[model samples]
Target chain A: MHPIAEPSLLLNTSICKANITKMAARIRGWQGDFRPHFKTHQSAKIGQWFRDAGVERITVSSFKMAHYFAQHGWKDITVALTCTPIHTAAINQLAATINLNILIEDVASIQALEDHLENPVGVFIKADTGYNRTGIDAEDFITLKKILAHLKDTKKLIFIGFLTHAGNTYHARNMAQIKKVVDPALEKMLALKTFLRKEFPLMELSWGDTPSCSIYNDFYGINEYRPGNFVFYDYTQVQIGSCSMNDVAVCMAAPVLATHPQRNEIVVHAGAIHLSKEYIQLPNGNISYGKVVKINHALEWDTHDIIGEVKSLSQEHGVISANKKIFAHIQPGDILGIIPVHSCLTAHLMKHFLTTEGNFIEMMK
Target chain B: MHPIAEPSLLLNTSICKANITKMAARIRGWQGDFRPHFKTHQSAKIGQWFRDAGVERITVSSFKMAHYFAQHGWKDITVALTCTPIHTAAINQLAATINLNILIEDVASIQALEDHLENPVGVFIKADTGYNRTGIDAEDFITLKKILAHLKDTKKLIFIGFLTHAGNTYHARNMAQIKKVVDPALEKMLALKTFLRKEFPLMELSWGDTPSCSIYNDFYGINEYRPGNFVFYDYTQVQIGSCSMNDVAVCMAAPVLATHPQRNEIVVHAGAIHLSKEYIQLPNGNISYGKVVKINHALEWDTHDIIGEVKSLSQEHGVISANKKIFAHIQPGDILGIIPVHSCLTAHLMKHFLTTEGNFIEMMK
Candidate 1:
């Protein structure tokens, strides 16, 4: 049965495949490992596409997600979120079956793992480098040394390397700005590695973010890259030049359900439930949370311009004010394509996706 | 297995139960039937609570959801979204087993549904009130009458009555504004019913929306009231006065992972993944997308007054600016409770809820 309207979620297979190729080439060029984050495109179908394009290792935000991808036969995995004491058993259980890498920042977390973990675990010491969310401060060498000293003899813990998210790329205004934030951070990590060589000569500097990963001409000290959103860049990435407008792999196809003459707006089937509320700061400082793209034949969308600004959103309806020129042509029953402000959140909200041909593609399943 | 941190979800069981009681009381006092919309608190546990509180019917946003609730023993269900051709089989399957109600705004949809349906399906005409979304225009009585006239002899189609979703309440500034928009719309529906009753004697008027359903004192012509968010009011509802701050039943319980003085902020585990991007416009027109609330032992949160505005959020972390006087008291590792700006999308993103006591309260399963 044909739906009265098109599904709000849409994923272009051709564009997705092209994105995978581009990300794989970038990783290969840098001589870095490609462990794409599963959180961006939680679909196993998308994961399979990644695997088919030669991606063997993967990263996920949660242990449950690791298990989700693992069930689909993914062998190597990294749970990127900090391991909580509550999830120790689940992690151990997962490790007993696959090569699982987990991240930790504090000694207390390590102690917690030591007390309860039953399986040997690959541990990555998370380093703080300006993102400042969940990592040990790089300048705090004493703290790092203390953690290394304690883990040296622990049979259950295998120190893998050091990991940094380099999330400041998200706030960067341009390529120069991204290099300004990431280059010094990479230098600091390399310096720390040199100073600690006598104690741990095998530490790897793992760093990744789509903005930095996509633009960097050099990976001087990085051993691994984890650019998840590169597979499906959104409005924010477009503004930062991380991905060209044509490179965005996913477009939410929403039906224009209502047009408000007074507001010069059209209501769409897509809302917060479909496209997440992540916003990009407009030049005027007001936010353009998302942009209306033009969905093409292959389900690929032309996202060169912002057709509509998501002025307000409810659960099931996104209130879009069509740009002056576009408003004149739009009406109820037409479809509008949207590129989310943040691809990660938008992908997470859509538990599954629909291909151009209308097949129900389950990404997580 | 224990997670390194608590999951970023919280369902206030006590507050949820209280919300149920209050909605039930209001419906009873207003002499209207309570058919709570399941889209907000999608949990079967919460739905069962409503059933136990004497609600015999409920509303869902999609057919997939209607089936989910039906499997949980909800016999009478309404799929409030516009009917489409693709969902006809599912709707027919559901109608065969339960008292299923569907909505349509145009003649083509009704014709498509009639062509594909095998069982008698209950249908309602979705009317376009002041909100101006999917519903057909009120002046199009000839079109509606033509639709009703066409369906008269179709054995598979059962014309029930007229249904209207006063979605304009989302734009209202407060309770006064919501009442101002909803009262007249309700009157319009009543007037339409009176006109239609002369030709079709068994017409019923069904109304949905938390703001319209909760604040209004009277429902003179409405037969059934369907309010979803009142089960778990969020920051938007608190501002609308449909429910008080203490009445909010669910929130995102994020861990304060790091404090960055350099950035003048603290990061939490919750982000757009947990809290959908629904926002509340402040009196000054600045937007507060989501608010940080207080999570107490009984799983009930304090009123919206305890709110600390979350200025900005990312995919994995939300940066709450400590620039405010109140945020200065917060420290790293404390849990920051967040009341989502829109509860509907946030509730839907969470596959299930976790109680304060750490039980997996599956919303679907």
Candidate 2:
């Protein structure tokens, strides 16, 4: 197929294997357990890559996703989101077979899990060190103490450790800024562990976020790692200095629908529906949806190769402001590769993927 | 079976039927052809409703969508996007069977169509009245003359009329701004039509944009009207004064996973991936992704009745900022209805829909 007049998400497995290998080597040097979050890819075939890279455990966002991957031979998993009462049955069903871990924030969630669970599952108290989206405030040890006391009575719950995600690191501008978020969060995790060690003696700390996990080499206070986006680091991570340009494994290949030589722009078929609406604010203050790249006949891209920037996007149209030289080569029936701003959302919107070797990879919806 | 942890796109048929009836009645009195855009709903079952309401024609955004509706008994359709060289085989395949109309913007597109088209397909020259997204500049009669000269030599093309969409009406703040965009576009359209009609005496004009078609009652110079988002107008249309709150037919029913009563916020499972990440700024300067409405036991929402606003969103989490009174009642296992900021993109993001009557409607992918 031409892949023009439509958008196709192209995956380079060779680059993806390199990314996986790089992350696996980093975790091995850190001497910590590698449990990459499966929410980023949500594909059984990609999960197999991690398994082959010696990643024994995994993390997912939903119990339904946990079920989907468990069916594909993932024996250990963590439903990373807050376990709610609505997911009681699905959680209990998965807990019966796998070494499932669930995040518990409030005592009510603990009570619901205690009343409904069929088998014992490891429970981690979600602590909010900084990015206060959700979770128990790390400063409020009283709430954690109460939840821990309540967990003592539950037969089906094993109070294991604390979990936190430095999602604020996504907004960091550089290396100094990323460590400003990672250092404090690690300090808070160790502080929380120190207080709990007096009572329980053995408590693990699990920190998961791509920026911190990719930049920081030392995980001295952390026990387990669960960074998802490193498998296909996007332009966001690249801008924040979390990963270099070579780490990005996925890019959108959209067909050129029209070329405006006077405007020096190329109109591509990929829009917000194909590439997600999330954008990266360049240092020059220009908002870019994605970075345009030239693809060879084999659909391989050199990320450092400068082409153009996707300037604006609407529902089904992406306007690329390229130079006259770049615009001269493109016509109505050409496909231009775009390194997406955020790979996770783009991959999710594109439910199916085509590998460079001409294979279709289907993700769990 | 329980849609508590995943986002569910909920459709209220009564409200949708009312919207369909209102548009159909308005178009009947206009004395022009009513070709409703099927890109909003994308469901064969919803197309049946338009068929039942006496809509003899339709407009779709892509050739694949046209093929879907053509299979479902849509005989008259306009593929309203720019027809590129890559879509020749599919367009010819479609033109062979139905009264297909495709948009042509440049002379290059015309020559390509002239070469590859197997059967005659009606062609509309896309004219830029106001929105300069795609189309020939309406004032550039030189390009139109060249295209017409080229079309005269073609064998398998029918030069029908000028087509346009006043897409800038979406960014209007009020009715006055909408009219500011609508009136001039109509003036230029008439000017273009008058210039073209001197040679082609039976020339027509086609205009389609939800705001323009909904607010303006006069279609004196237009022979065809094609509006899509009026089928399920969202908060953006409501903000622009094209439709009231009562006119919106579709709202997303998302699950409440957690609540922060102290902060007066609720964490929802619906996020940018589910709701398409489109936002509408409130009068108070707060950004809202969607309007929250109370859901009854049957998951139906009264469009006028709103409880709170979805304040912010990440990839998998939407934070709803509500009052203490609203937060006091919600728990971890509740479903809330959200009237999306943009219905067209939201509907396209959700692959399927569930009506209030518990019927599942599958859209064309």
Location of the lowest summed lDDT over 10 successive residues in candidate 1 chain A:
A1-10
Query: Candidate 2 lDDT, tens digit per residue, B123-156?
Result: 8988888676788888888888998898888888
Per-residue lDDT of A1-365 in model 1, one digit per residue for the tens? 22425445676677878988988998898888888887888888888889888889998887778999888899999888766455677888899899999887656667778888888888888888877777778878898888887788677778988888888888887889988998888987888789887778788888878898888887786788888888888778988878777777677877776565555677777776777766677777666657886565455556665576776666677778676677667655567788788877877777777776767677663
TM-scores for chain A, candidates in order? 0.94, 0.97
* TM-score against truth, every candidate: 0.85, 0.96
Cα lDDT over the full model 1:
0.76
Q: What is the lDDT of residue A301 in candidate 1?
A: 59
What is candidate 1's lDDT per residue for B187-213, written digit by digit as tens? 778878877888888888888888877
CAPRI-style class, candidate 2: medium
- The candidates' interface RMSDs, in order, read 3.7, 1.7
